[model samples]
Target: MLKKLYLLPLCLIFFVPLIVCEKILILPDHLKNFWIAGVNFDYFSYYKSKVLLILVLFSLISLLYRLRKDEISIKSSKLYIPLFVYLFFIIMSTIFSKYKDISLWGFPDRYEGAMVLFSYIIIFFVFALVPKIKDTQIILNSFLISSFLIGVISMLQFFNLDFIKSYIVGKLHIFQLQYLGKVYIKFNPGPRYVYATLYNSNYVGSFMAISFIVTFILYVLNNEKKRIIYGILSVIMFFSLIACHSRAGILGVMVAVIFFAVYKYKEILKNFKFVAPILIIYLLVYVFINTLSSSYIGNKIESLFVDINKTITNSTNNNLRDVKIYNNAVCLNFDKATLNFVFDNEKIFATDENNKRVSFKFDSNKNEFLFENPTYSQLKYFINNYNNMPVLILNNGYDNLNLIKTKEGFKILSFSGKINNINPVDKIDVKGKEKLGSGRVYIWSRSIPLIKNTLFLGYGPDTYALYFPQYDYIGKFLFLGTPSILVDKPHNMYLQNAINIGVIGTLAFLIFILCYLIFSFKAINTLKDSSLSTISISIFFALIAYLVAGVFNDSVVYVAPLFWALGGLNFKILNN
Candidate 1:
């Protein structure tokens, strides 16, 4: 029973990836809107939370069973001190939070509340306590197999072979096929970015990025026959990572690769004959894949420069010039009567048989627009200027409109007459870059002011959303386009930590990571001659990759567990 209980975590490991499709699981109507601690619990979070609870329970049971038998004794380590300190700070932040519900249970959209954080800590402790070599092997192998399956699915999705995706979606009745379908329509005539079992393409990229590194480490540690297998898996993951079209993932992988090469220079030199051929083959395959999808991949890569330029220019000037133009343009609204008067000779305005104004409401679900009697020029102008304008002219008054492209023409997804509550569209920058990540520069700039008062204790855990609106400089201007948009996360995990738990908590967390790095680096240097040293080195660089990627993405349900689990594994290996 004790042994069986210890293996339960391996089951948890397998189900982690399945969370992507878990939404498909059918739940009763009443259960669908289930609430836990005042938070609306979705099926995905419920399933994951249950699994974690069971795992923690079994781990405790196993520990108690072992203690009774006098077979094993619990040991204390200083490595856990910082983790405890971090947890203490997190609890304090949660207690002092203005939005206690959000801090404790998280937002409905992202359920990484106190419960999830505690589960992560529990998982870390489970791995650290049960660091048996066989268990470690089981966990690592499970990760590789799951990631390979995910990569294959993503590849199939990319190639438009929807059999697997359709079957899975069918099984998960609630899963929205349109979420994936809409990506193709949104970026028509371009390669469809595959998200696989994850929520988004960037997430898939991050998963594959780490998997590629792990496979490389496996290839290094294995025999020649096993090397061939690992090599093939690595190639598949590499292509999958690129196919995700995540700039941060790509940059992170490159950084990790460079770090690995520099750290293992001598080993690489020694194995140059064996490594050179593989490197050449990989390069050739990468080039072939890039050529096949050059248009899609090339455009994504080029956008990095556009993003950088937008950031740089925004730093110097506020980019308020375009905002002023947009405001002035939107404020000059021409009503139906006014439009009819302006085009009195032309039959542009729609009217009823009684000559009354015909009211129109944009259907959010559909992707086509029908003009009652619009001229070609008027229709074209509306389509062209729709996204830039804060509010568009309607029969009643100026209303918000989102012009989305369709096979027929541009259609409005949203239309509302109330200007005060308009869902503002993302504005184009002075350099013509549209939707520059919700004006991240402006958001970050605003975050600085928020941290001024909450320097030490922070606003509280998961309270960034609560405080974000108050200091949102760009949000006020852009609210006309996306009034309902939630600036919940800073998009930078470092900033997220600073705002969530303050400087002390953030430092405690950073110090814990720093200590792990120090110990792992020491282990790598000390065990330089060991066959498994490559694993240590690989994990170190992989963590670095994830850290760099975290600068662009906050820690989320999909990736954070894997990081913490691996960190635990690293600590265990170092201690042993």
Candidate 2:
């Protein structure tokens, strides 16, 4: 039974969700600022890597044994050529990487090293090459079953009854960590970011998207007793997707559904009745959730077009009133008048709303301008995140004033807008739009430049953090709201590949994936009403959905294994 079910162990990947781990960097004197203390937890990547490594080894041996007995060779698959090219580049990158040890095994927190990359590739080759149609069918069923449980847990988390969290599940939960020789556990504080087993809410969004696509495809294909089961699963996964509030996942859903419609147009048209009710239910649920959550769905969509610089500028506009920036100065417009305050060349020049320059006494001892205009005395100000975010507080001094001056500098904290005096070219850059897509733009901008180094080969797999300008303090503080925050992943899969394995390798990876997609696409017409065809089409779109979501999400241990496994299945089906 174990021999027949040799592939069943691959399904264990569904149980391993990803969490950001911190590791104490044992570095040289220069790289001391890398981290204060690392986030190493035994629950995630360490265990995940171990499991994947075992799977890789087992799969490799099994494939080789099968090859010895059959005409099948790994080289026979068209995928091998491109994948080999990608692997070659990754090897070169690993060898040439400054942090060779890290390149081989991955960074301390992230375990997506060269070895792990091979694990992913082997997992792909195993399912794609080794699985028979009958065996693949069982694996697909396992996926749906696992997804049902993931949906249930996510639903529980959404409703604030997360029983699987560390506090309740002991050490089995993903958030358990050991830092500084002490157990540092991440507990759900309350009904906030309901990540479920995926650890990050964004990952949950991406996971649900794949699940939803598969469930939808499977449900649509079945005109039998199992149809209702898959329909319910679709709804569950859809709800989970929306609950996670990941806009990228939503984008993926849109792209996949469009392609799904194109592929299954005839089936959808014939079974319009079956599809209608489910879609309506989805619409109703989406509407209800959005209504309850202050129309965040609408806001999130609308924010994509809105200028982030203006948003930041307007954050404290109520406090500062209408501000018009002049040359090293700003004109504050009010209901009755305006105050023109100039700070050019470290000198204070104040003009009242009456269009007359107010004679302000400079108290050099106290570092404050004393304006004598019968309306105010001393111009005192500071900065804080009062109710909003990084906002400047300026007024008369006192608790009643709210602008009481402390020893702290009147720091801007970090201003993302134009201190550049609004030139014609409009060079606001990514920092100005850091809040866009929840800072995806900032991450992308930073990651794009490193693509140059990867024109031939990358820095190395999972060495993104080591190369990223974590010391861009102003950018970090302004965009990420903290200078000390760690950027572990590029939050984009393609960018991740380009940075880790190099652009040439990324192209190879693209070719490998695109070959599968194109093959599946072309094979759809040849497919009849058989269960194998149904499973094939379903897994095909699931892969599409997962890749689409990868635009705004990096590949993580939680989701990548299942993707690779299923993607391999598609490769097997489409090629055969």
Candidate 3:
């Protein structure tokens, strides 16, 4: 029975490929289009849940078979305290939740507590059971092969290679061509980007970032022959990353690179005399190739490096073009610029019916600008009579809604053409007023009051969004950006977990991160094997990258390939 353990690795190799194949097999159809569900299967349909249940059952059966045959030890304990906390919250949440029915199970819009619980459990299981280092190799090999195949396909699509396209289209029924499909010709001469088995460019960027880190780690450990092969793949991954045009993904990889340098700080200095010139040559080569690339690449690089301070003084428009300029310019002068633009520009200028001043706001980011009219804008016609005396002129100078100075000593604008007696700016109108303008700091601020309510057992997983609005704004800006957008999950994962299961859950999650850090640090110290050391170090760096990136994006909340890579590595480290 113990001998069968060897077969387990082979099974994993095949199993990993099968998963990859499943993704590839569905690509042509799912990649091009999206659907809610089948005609018979509506929202919160049982189909996806049933499939997950089957997989869980199969895994359990496999474990039992191994245990009965004495092929594997099924030693287990309450090893997942953090997960247990999450489960605890789910149950607690069932009682106080405004939407308990949806919270306990699945929702019409998205997954419920039970489904999220399983995601946590499955991840924890994979981390605890999957063996170290070897499993990482299997995953990496699968990624490399899968990415290469997809890259080849995208290239074939690029040249209008009709026969190949038709052959693939026929094979994959769902895939249709529109604007060069996954690999746009604008990026390069061939398949410039690798959408791979994912639907969106952002996913492609994320996958490439993780794969590139893996390739770099592998290259550092590879023999001469392997080095050449992996090195070429690394270059391919780099181009693929650039083609995705995902700023967050690029930032994530950059963080990983910085971590790599920091991890090797001592070694780097010790060998600086020998390594300095080699590093210089690599930099030179990279720059030379970048220079020869398309104008788009050159422009993007230039845009990345442009000085923000010099650009902000030149503009006031808040359209996408203006916003990009402003975003770059405000990099150094955010607060001052926002204030000047707001107050000086009369960003909130409106007039009441009695000719009193009302309020409004101007918000701009990238291509999106929010011009919220609390009151005044230009009227359609000139000053003709007192009856039509009031008008609104937005910064763009358009009057769609009625703005009036009322005799009731208040300035008001009816969202509709006709006036409504109800006041829209009442305290009840807004959400999360107490924590407004604080961004992620709202989580910390709001948590203090919530903990007083339930010190031992708190709210539930994903409960932050519902409770946050109870905290009113603090007379500043509205929560309009990153932290506010991610109100779905608390901006801080630690705080979110803590609020859900009280202090215990929060501590457990921290301990897991701490444990992984300590173990990886020790591995770096004791392992004289360069290959093992490089991979371990890279994994450590990648984890940090994800954490930092999470500050701005809801990464851990979603199941991206990066999470899988990180979990697999953490599992490997503990087992090793």
Candidate 4:
């Protein structure tokens, strides 16, 4: 029973990824900038945290008893020094954080706070320090089984066969909470376009980026009968990943395949029989993608081979050339009205649907638009002449438009006559980008300026959202189609750590990961045992795939724990 402690982390990798539910949350006031007051539907992180805490509690008690009895020994101590340094910075950052409550437990939606970070450490250590576990195969199999199921469900969802979206699922999935005034939220399986358990299609893509290659490599490494099963699962995972229509995920898969090929070129040359069948299956999938009954998966796959820009446009829709927002203004050129905006010398010129020209007066002192002799019944309006994106259209009765251009951007007063944070569509200087990753360009440009202030100690764990320029209403409106969405995550994992844990802590984490990668390569090259070599190399390539995906996706709770679990397994294989 005592030796069965390893099963705890297995549960995290298996059950946690499969779980999704709508749970209620009471959000703090400061978070009201985006999160609704005392209401949320946490489909990803809530249950994962519950499982994590339970595992951590049990794992800690067992670890303490073993340490007292001198039953375990951690090898390669120098590799872990940076990990401890990182842990120190995490604690310090949390201690000095302004939003300590949020720093400790994390936000309701993400749940990636100091506590979760601490749990990750314990999870990593459980696999790293545990002596000579015989059931490591079970760990990989558990993840394989879990990912296969996710692939099946995602495939079903892409074809609109998801039972989770049915009425029966809603009636069956209700729970009673105390003091929440009968809080009930519907189970949203995200978009119908192949979003599985993860909340967003982008996150689903990231999750598959990690799992797909691991499953594929397992196919390459296993025996004949087992390899066939893994090969089929690998094909399913690849199809589901394509169904997600996430460009970042596809890029990560490409990187992972390139790295794995180079890493094991010699072995591939030695074992052509083992590698040929999977390659054939892969070619078949690539050729017949259109036959798959799904949403835009066929188009996305074809775009990769044909027109890349179309895929980029479909993926994010924030095409720089065709974007709805531009420098200090929203662009109305792409709208159905086909109206154009020209701001000249503080004068507003609007061409109506009937092509009638109307002029509006701008009062600098009062910060209001004054329309004179309006010939058109409907006219588009911007916050100011300098930045013109059509957010509001005034009726023929003239204008009550209170528009002001602030140093940051533009602000418009609410209809209630009270000053609100209602900023219109505005963007900084992003010129001629004109494609899908342009949205990344918008956020990255804004997020980089904020890093200068957080070089020493960051805002705190999971605190990236608080400092981000959520009032960049124009950027949000153009890229995301709504200013109400919070810029809670920095998408890039490196930027997230730099903002949340400071650049120093990020450097420490980098050092730790670098050391692990170096060690993994050394182990694989020098590994004498056939089975051990496969395990180490598979884990290495999988981690590489995930880190590549992290360039575009944030380390969200739904997918990141599995990466950490695989990290632990690498240590186990190397040290043992």
lDDT of 2 by residue, 83-111 (tens): 89988988999999988877887765457
Give the top-scoring candidate (TM-score).
4
lDDT of 4 by residue, 473-551 (tens): 4455445544446778878998898988899999999999999998888877777776667777777888888888888
Comparison by TM-score, 2 against 4, better one: 4
lDDT of 1 by residue, 437-512 (tens): 5356556655666676666787776667767653222243342244335576777788888888787878888888
Model 3, range 1-576, lDDT digits (tens) per residue? 563353243233212211211112121231122221111112112333334344444544555555677744534434455456545555665556555544454432223254544544553454345433455555546556655554444333323342333433443444324323552211122333333334334445555566666665555545446666666666566656665554445667788877776767676566565446544644554465455454454555454334222233333322111111121111111211221121112133323333344343333332122334412121111111125433321122322222233444222233224342322221222222232212444444444555555455556544555555422311112233211122445545456555554665556556656665665666566766566666666666666655544543342322232354355445554445
True lDDT of residue 223, candidate 4? 58
**What's the lDDT for all of these models?**
0.60, 0.69, 0.43, 0.69
Of the two candidates 1 and 4, the one with more favorable TM-score, higher being better, is 4
- The clash count of every prediction, one per candidate, is 8, 7, 25, 6
lDDT of 4 at 323: 24
Give the C-alpha lDDT of model 4.
0.69
The local lDDT score (0 to 100) that residue 48 gets in candidate 2 is 65
Off by over 4 Å in 4: 1-6, 131-133, 167-192, 286-295, 301-348, 351-391, 394-410, 413-428
